[model samples]
Target: MARQLRERAEQHTETHLTLRDLRHVCWDPVPGAVVYVCENPRVVEAAADAGMDAGLVCTSGNATTVVHTLLTALVEGGTRLYVRGDFDWAGVAMVERLLTRYPAQPWRMSAADYEQQVERARDRRTPLQPLEGRPQTASWDPELAPSMNSFGMAVHEESALDLLVQDLRQRP
Candidate 1:
């Protein structure tokens, strides 16, 4: 299964695995191997376009059972996971849940990254929607929540695609 996944990634294809597909298969990752998970499909698409061989998974918003199953398999096999999402209340909540449940680290989902993106948005004159819903705290980074609440804007994953793709390219 790991070989097959690598083949698909080598071809720059987006492979969507269902819960049924992963139920009986084991993803025996290379020890200490890294995989990136994100909330939106656009990041995956962008990575594909860049022909990145690094493993990337998209949850398409809040993770479904399929996402959980895939992540569980990789994590159990000793794969290091880096996850990111939109800079919004709901996105933070999703990240919080994943980080709490898995041994995953935040992938550019920090307060500093948020502030940089906010500045980029402003410089580009791209209008960001005001944050909605209740504020969410990021346990991994103590300053993340306060920084986000102070900005009062939401930065979608699309805005940071270039940085993400660049990171993927740099992965060993």
Candidate 2:
């Protein structure tokens, strides 16, 4: 299922994973290896297109049970998770939940990253909509939520796609 998802993105690739399929799939991650997690699959697709031989996973929003299963297996094998998501209330909630489950390192879900993307979105004239719903604290970056609320901006992963792809490109 993971390999199938890694192929070129198609319009109809939003299928859910079954526990049976999850049980059979195996990725014996190297000890102390790093795996990248993102909310949007586009980030994964972009990284793959950049020829990144990376351990990447896409949660496709709130993350499914299959994602949790995959993450658990990777952590048990000593793989560190580096996660990123949309810079919004929902994004923060998702990150907080993941942090509670595993000792995952945050990727671009930082106050600095949020601020920079907010500026970039402005420069690009992209609509900076006010963060909706209740704001949630970032378990990884303490200041991220306050800063995001103050700025009233949400930075989606696409804004930092190139930077993430660069990280993947430079991976040894």
Candidate 3:
């Protein structure tokens, strides 16, 4: 039997994402198309698993330099962005900041929605981390921040994956 040699491909700095990477892939310019945005990668990754096409973008955390550029491109192309973040002070702040740059809708980011999820989490014994820092008002839904503080628990996007996936799977 001949011995088989398995060689791993070495990765370099050039392997990372760059402006040029997007140039070759011809994405349809769908103005006003719904683009699902998430603060964390897991939520967006699940959306990908559920077969989302070209309209999903995950910030992975706070909007970095690259994120700002990508978001600018999407908005400039006229895609409607719907963003959902963790239910915490930082989350509210992130949404507030994004609103200044782009017109993004807050998906599943409301007082009623948070309350419902909190109830479900309590019933299922899903451990929730406490909300951190002082709260900030959500410009899109003024009630959202107060409601989150009233609940005093952080409900991450991962907790509401199934519901979000349903929205993504719907055919308009």
Candidate 4:
């Protein structure tokens, strides 16, 4: 499946396929396929280096037009996306955007998950100002936003990666 996706992406690039054109290709279902959404290249690189077997795709931050096209293709093919990002407003916003675009399961981004991590947080930093925007209800788990607000700090997904990788390893 990964090879097929890579080939499709390469073909699309070589042919200069428009986003509209790429959108029409239905992706085959890759059950348990996981896509990591991150703003940082290191996260993507690390995931690759660690040989994480999920169908990983790097968002490179805000979804570029290409990333959007790729994700659309992946979702259409039945790939269930799992996202992780910085636990700030921007990260939340990115998750929201992807949720809007594709059907995705929250990857340890729930309120309960955050609470557990918060309890273990060392050298915790206070949330920065300009917290005016409302957080969206997590589609996979509704309590996530409220928990984040109540905690008054952002817990980046990277900080909880060990737990995430463990969960991934255990996925059927």
- The prediction achieving the highest lDDT against the true structure is 1
| Sort order, TM-score high to low | 1, 2, 3, 4
lDDT, residue 134, candidate 1? 95
TM-score of each: 0.94, 0.86, 0.83, 0.68
Greater-lDDT candidate between 2 and 4: 2
Sorting all predicted structures by lDDT, with the top scorer first, yields: 1, 2, 3, 4
How far in Å is the alpha carbon of 151 misplaced in model 1? Answer: 1.4
Residues 84-152, candidate 3, lDDT per residue (tens digit)? 788888887887788767998888888898999999888989899998898888888888878887889
Q: Which candidate wins on TM-score?
A: 1
**lDDT at position 154, candidate 2:** 75
Cα displacement (Å) at residue 149, model 1: 1.6
Candidate 4 deviant stretches above 4 angstroms: 1-36, 123-136
lDDT of 2 by residue, 33-61 (tens): 98888899888778766667777788999
**Residue 116 local lDDT, model 1:** 99
The per-candidate count of clashes, in order, stands at: 0, 0, 0, 2
Winner on lDDT (1 vs 3): 1
> Cα lDDT of all candidates, in order?
0.90, 0.81, 0.74, 0.63
